[model samples]
Target: MTRRTRRTRPSPTALPGRTVPVAGSIAAQSPHHCRTSPFSSRLSYDSESMRCRKGRTPRTLILPLAPTGPMIRRMPPLLTIHFLPTTVESARLAGTVAVMIDVLRASTTVTHALAAGCDSIRPCRDVVEARQLAARPPACPDNLGPLLAGERGGTRIDGFDLGNSPSHFTTTAVGGRTIIFTTTNGTSALEHCRPADMVLVAAFCNIRAVADTLVQRNQPVHLVCAGTDGEITAEDCLCAGAIGLELQDHGGFDTHSHDATRIAISRYQQLAHDSDQLLAELRDSHGGRNLQKLGFDDDIAFACRHDTIDLVPAFDTHSSTIRTLS
Candidate 1:
C-alpha cells in the first residue's frame, strides 16, 4: 500500500489585507506584497482582492447595460382624433387632440395667421357665435377679443371682420390680434376635435415643420382632414397623409390607415413625383379645383410647399385658442 501525504491549504483569514497567492507563480508563497504583474505593471489584477490595479476600471464608475433603442428621457403621451366621413359634430371632439386640416384654405390661412404673428385663434362652429363675438366690442371680457373671420361658400361672410385667406393674414392686419375664426369646413373640423388634449391646425404649407414638432413632442398624433362640405376631399387627405408619413419616419408613430387616409397617402406618394409635382397635385385636387375656379390657383400653389415655417400652434383649451408651442 502506498502512503499518501495530506496537502495543507492556505487559510483565507491568514492572508493579510485580503491578499492571496496566485497559482503557478514564484511569488505565490511569498508574504511580500508585489503590486506589479508580469503581464503589465499598469494592468495588475489581485485575484484574492477582486480589484484591478491602477488605470483600469475606475471605482467610481457605475455602468449599466446599454439599452437597445433610442433612450427618450421624457416621452410625450399618445393622442388620437377620430376622422368622421360626415360633417364634424361637436360630440366627436370630446377628450381628443383635434387636428383641423383644411388643406385648401382654412388650415393654410391659420398657418399664415400664426406665421404673421397672430396672437391666437378661436375656432367657432356656429356662425352665430362668431357673429355675436364679432358684434361685441374687441374689449369685451366675455369674448376672445379677436377679430371675427370666416367664409361661407368660399365668400367672406357678410359683416365679418376678415375673410379666410392665407394672404389676408398679414402682419399689417392680424399682428397681435386674436382671430375668432369660423369656416364652412375648417372650423367644423376644429369643432369636431375640440375634445383632444391639443388641437392643431395643419396644411401642406407647414407640413414638415409640423411633423418635426409632433416628433419632438413624442405624442401619438392624429391628422384630421377637413374635407369639403360633408364629402371627402383629396387635397386634405393628401396633406394629412403627408403629415402621417412624416410622423411615422421621425417618431415611429403608427397610423392605422382608413380608406380615405390610405388613398391619400398612396395618391400623394404616386402623383407627387417631386416637390414641384406635389404643388401641381394640390392645384388639381378637389379643393384646389374650387380654388382654381375662385381664381386662387396661386394660393394653392404657394401653400403646397413643405417646411415653409417652423411654427407649431397648440390648442389652449382653457382659453379656447391656438397658441404657438415653444
Candidate 2:
C-alpha cells in the first residue's frame, strides 16, 4: 500500500493538465469544491524521486517518489465500471481489484452487519446454496449458527432469517453472528468477479472508506455495479461515480477511461447537493421503485448516507467470506 505524508506551502499555479491528489486525509469538500484558502493545497504523490521537495509551493505539494520502484509508465487505471453482469465471466476485470456495488440494500446491509459486529459474512451464490451453508456452517472460533439472509425480486425469500434490508441487520439480531448472505444483485456480482485479483463489497454507507482503501492500495481497479436485474441502476452508477471522484482526488488520473469515469462523475456532481432531489431520483429509479414497492423506504434513506459506517469489507479469497479491515 502507498503511504502519504502531508506538507504545506504557499499555493502555486498548477501546471496545465495536471490534477493533484488531496493528500493524507480525504479533502472535506465537494467533488466540485473550490478553494480560496492559500494553504488549502495538499501534497501529490510523485512517482519519480524519493523525497518531498521544498521548492515552489504549488496548489498541491508534489512529493518526490522512490527513484526506482515498480514503475509502470502506462496510463493509470481508469475508474471503470461494468453496469451489470449477465454472465460471471468478465474479461476486462480479469485481474483487477473489483468492488461490487449494490447501494439500495445488499451492500448497505452487509456493511451494516459488519459494523454492527457480525464476525464475518459468507456470501453464497444462490438462495439454495445459502441455505445449505446456513445448515452446515464451516468450523470457526465461534460455533454459532450463521444467520440466513437474502432476497428475491426485491422481496424476502421464505425461511430466511433476514431479508436484504439494512434495518434488519442491527446489532441485537446480527452481532457476533456469521452471516450466510445471498442477495439478488450484490452476491451475483461477487461471484462474477471471482476472476478479480481482489473483491470488495461497497455502498454509499461506506463509500469513503472504500475509496480510501483503494487509494492506499495504489492499484488499478474495476468497479462492478450489481445492477437491478440485468440493467443499469442509477443508484449504483451514482455510487460508482462517487468512487471515481474520490479516486481522482488521490492522483488516480493519467490512467483511466474518460468515457466511463466522465459520465459517472457528471451524474454524481449534478445531484450531489439537494438531498431531497437525490432521494427523489433514487426513489424513481428502477431498483429504488422495486425496493419502495416492497416497503423498504427506510432502507432507501439508510443507503443514501455517505461515510456513516467506517468499515471496508473485503472478500477473503481463501475463506470465501467478507471480512472487515480495521
Candidate 3:
C-alpha cells in the first residue's frame, strides 16, 4: 500500500500561523480576499518583512502626490543645503558639514596651496593667531618652516611671506611648505565652521571635485559664502549653485535651498550659453568690485574658471589645518 501526505489549509478567519496556506492560494478561496491579510489593518506594507497582501506591492498604494503651486520638494533627513550672504549667518554649521567658498580668491588660493604640495593650510580668523602659528615650528616629519600667508584689503599683509592670491601659490613658493593662512573673509568663514563635522574649502576651480568628495562621504553639507563685508555676493552664490547642481546629480540625498540658492541656480543656467558673460558678471559683483578697486582684478578672473584642479581640501580640526583628502 502507498502512503500519502495531506496538506492542511488554515481557516479564513484564522490568524497567520505555521499551517497557513500559501498567500495566493488562500486569497483565491476567499470572496473578501481584497479585504484580508496584515496589510488590511494598517494600509501599508512591512518594509523589512517583504510580505504584503496577495495582490499588493508596497509602492502601488504609497505613490507620491504631484507637487502643485510653487511646491518645494521636501528634503531627506541626512542632507541639507543652506544659502547665506555671510559667514556670520553660518554660525549654525557647528555640527554639520560646512563648505566655505570665496571663489574670487581665498578658497582658490588655499586649494592651489594644497595642490602645490603644501603639507597643510592653517586657516585663522584672527590675524594675531595667524602670526603666532607662523612663528611656531612644524609638528610633523614632512614639515617645512611655517610660511606666513594672508591678506588685508586685497594686499599682502605687511611682512608676510605670501598674499591671499592663487597666483602666489606656485610650486616654487608653496612646495614643501606649511602655510599659516589668514584672510579678511574666507578664513573667518572657515573659522565659523570650525566646530563642524567636517569643514571644506571650495571654489570654482575645484567645485566638481569637491562635490564628488562630498557625495562619497554622504554627510550633511552646508555651503557658507564669504560675502563682501557681511553682504551678499553674487559670485559666491553662483559657486554654491554649481555645487548644488552637482549634488543633485549624485542622487542619494535631498537638497534644501533658500531663495538665494534658487536665484543663483537660475542665474547659472541663464549664463550657461556664454561663460564669458558669466565671468563678466563677476566683475560687477560686490566682492569683485571691491577687489578691483583694491587692484586685484586679475584674481577675480583666475577664480572664474571651472574645474581648474582636482584637489579637494578638507579641514583637519585636530591639526587646525586644511589638507588634501586622500
TM-score of each: 0.68, 0.76, 0.72
Candidate topping TM-score: 2
Worst 10 residues of 3 by lDDT: 1-10
Decoy 1 TM-score against native = 0.68
lDDT of 2 by residue, 220-273 (tens): 778788888888899998888777776765564432555766787777767765
lDDT of 1 by residue, 1-326 (tens): 11122122112232221222223221232222224212233334444432223342211212234477754444333434234435345555555455778877888888767766677788888789887766673553334466889788877888887887676776667777888888888877776676766777787656755765665445556677778877777778777767765544343444444454555555656644454455666676777888788776656755654434445667776777777765
Segments in model 3 whose C-alpha atoms lie over 4 Å from true places: 1-91, 140-144, 256-258
Give me the runs in candidate 1 sitting further than 4 Å from their true place: 1-96, 137-145, 256-262
Worst 10 residues of 2 by lDDT: 8-17
RMSD to true structure for each model, in Å: 25.5, 11.0, 22.1
Query: Candidate 2, clashing residue pairs?
Result: 12-58, 49-65, 50-65, 75-255, 76-254, 76-255, 77-255, 78-256
lDDT of 3 by residue, 63-156 (tens): 2455776545444324444444342355566667788888777888998777666777878887788888767766744555788898888789
